[model samples]
Target chain A: MKLTVLYFAWVRERIGLPRETIETDAATVADLVEELRGREPRYELAFADLSALRVAVDQELADFDAPVRDVTEIAFFPPMTGG
Target chain B: MAVRVQQEDFDFGAEADAFAEGRADAGAVVTFTGLVRDRPDGGLREMEIEHYPAMTERAIAAIEAEAVSRWNLVDSLILHRYGRLRPGARIMMVATAAPHRADAFAAAEFLMDYLKSRAPFWKKEVTDAGAEWVAAQAEDEAALGRW
Candidate 1:
């Protein structure tokens, strides 16, 4: 499946891009993270601490265990500091 | 009820009046505005707020719905701004209306609490020294436990 992955805040800064299109067979968000981590050192560093990050699948908040199959977009960022 | 995420600033007085207009049953209206504050040293030049456009509206809508249900609110409005803002600029505002003061106040606080930690907006402060992202506070997350 083709997925459009997005990064925000420091996650985007660390990864050096705001968004990317990935063709992968990973079935879950955790799996996709591992796949991306293997593709480059930047991914490894940015995702080094999953506890510091939050994710959304198809624009809705979801956990790392959330399945990625049949999903079109995934966004990764730090805990929000909004008001 | 309305939830709006925009890049432009809003008028607080006009919005407040409109929110309460024609709602004779509503005896109380509460509002909270968040502004960009400079550091104590006063070197802060600007604040750039970034948000997930696709999700911001939906997330705030869900929050508004919850507040309305919990407090039996007559109406509510949430306006959050993004992009560049100078110090003292308004960043966001939340207004709530209910039949009584307690429900209006509590619901407004609840909206602010959830909006602070749950909404997908992030703030980056740029100063004469450098640019830095605002870190999320542990206290903000813990505040959710009360609700």
Candidate 2:
């Protein structure tokens, strides 16, 4: 499956890019995180603490354990400080 | 219901008036405006707000729908600005109209609470020392527990 992953705020700064396309067989958000972690140290550092981050699958907020099959987009960012 | 996410400032008076127009049944209209506060030292230069453009609209619309359902609101409005803004600039606004003051006020607060924690926007404050992304406070998340 091909997925478009987005990073925002400090996560984007740390990861050095805003978005990317990755081809993977990962079935869950966690699995995708592991795949990204194996790619390089920057991803490992950006994803160092999953608790400090949030995930959205297909633009809707989802848990890390959420399934990712057939999902086209995924975004990861720090806790929002909006309003 | 109206939800807007843009990089431009909005007129509060016009928005409030427009929200109440033709809604004679709504006896009360409550509005809350969020501003960019300067640092305590008074050296803040600007605030940069970043957001996921596509997701921001969808998220605010969902929040507005929840508020409408929970409070039976007559109408609701949410306008948030991104990009660079200086101190005293309006950051966002949430307005709610209802038959009574309680519902209007409550719905406005509920919208703000959800917007602060659930929305996709992130704020970074720039000061004379440096620029830093504003961290989400625990108190903001705790505020949602009351709802």
| DockQ result, candidate 1 | 0.91
Each candidate's DockQ: 0.91, 0.93
Off by over 4 Å in 1: none
lDDT of 2 at B109: 95
Which segments of model 2 are wrong by more than 4 Å? none
Clash pairs of candidate 2? none
Model 2 docking category: high
lDDT of 2 by residue, B14-122 (tens): 9888888898889999999999999998988999999998799999999999998899688899999999999999999999989999999999999999999999999
Candidate 2 clashes: the total is: 0
Chain B TM-score, candidates in order: 0.98, 0.97
Recovered fraction of real interface contacts per model: 0.86, 0.90
Decoy 1 TM-score against native: 0.98
